[model samples]
Target: ELKVEQNPLFLSMQEGKNYTIYCNYSTTSDRLYWYRQDPGKSLESLFVLLSNGAVKQEGRLMASLDTKARLSTLHITAAVHDLSATYFCAAEPSFNNDMRFGAGTRLTVKP
Candidate 1:
């Protein structure tokens, strides 16, 4: 089975609003990561967490990982048009080199 899953494949958020996305995995993993992508652009690495209780944030986004629970969270403090993009969470399995990505949360920040 795939290791990673994310909810709300599409998120329509208003400016100055706050929201959170959830990522759940099926098994233990070596690493978890969050990435953002703009239209027609490559992914922009957001966070890489290797252990449980690891949390990191930049700008309006915050990410956390809990290895024991096999879950991750991405919180958006205040949405903006500039923050409109696709967010993905990935996991590297403990026994394999492959990384599995979530379907992705597409955030649309409206004015």
Candidate 2:
């Protein structure tokens, strides 16, 4: 089976609300990354977690990696209409550079 999994394939949030997305991997990996994509748009880089306890944030998003637990988290703070997009978390195995992405969390931020 693929190494990574994410919950809630779809999410809808009202403006000013908050939510957290979870990512779990089946095996050890060297890196974890998060990305966002708007409708019909390319991905926008969110965070890159390279080691255990690695955390990064930009704007309304925050991401963290726990290599020991083979998990990652993407927390969204204060949703907005503009935040409507699909969020994906990917994991790269320690032995290889190829990364695998989650099915994706399709978020809709209502006005």
RMSD of 2: 1.1
Clashing pairs in 1: none
User: Which ten-residue region of model 1 has the weakest summed lDDT?
Assistant: 1-10
Judge candidate 2 against the unseen true structure and give its global Cα lDDT, from 0 to 1: 0.89
Candidate 1, residues 6-104, lDDT tens digits: the string is 998999989999999999999889899899999999999999989899999999999998888889999999888999999999998888978999999
- The C-alpha lDDT values of all candidates are 0.92, 0.89
lDDT (Cα, tens digit) per residue for candidate 2, span 1-111: 447899888999999999999999988888898989988999888888998999898989889988888889999899888888899999988788889999999999998
lDDT of 2 at 7: 84
Best by the lDDT measure: 1
Residue-pair clashes, model 2: 0
Cand. 1 TM to true fold: 0.95
Off by over 4 Å in 1: none
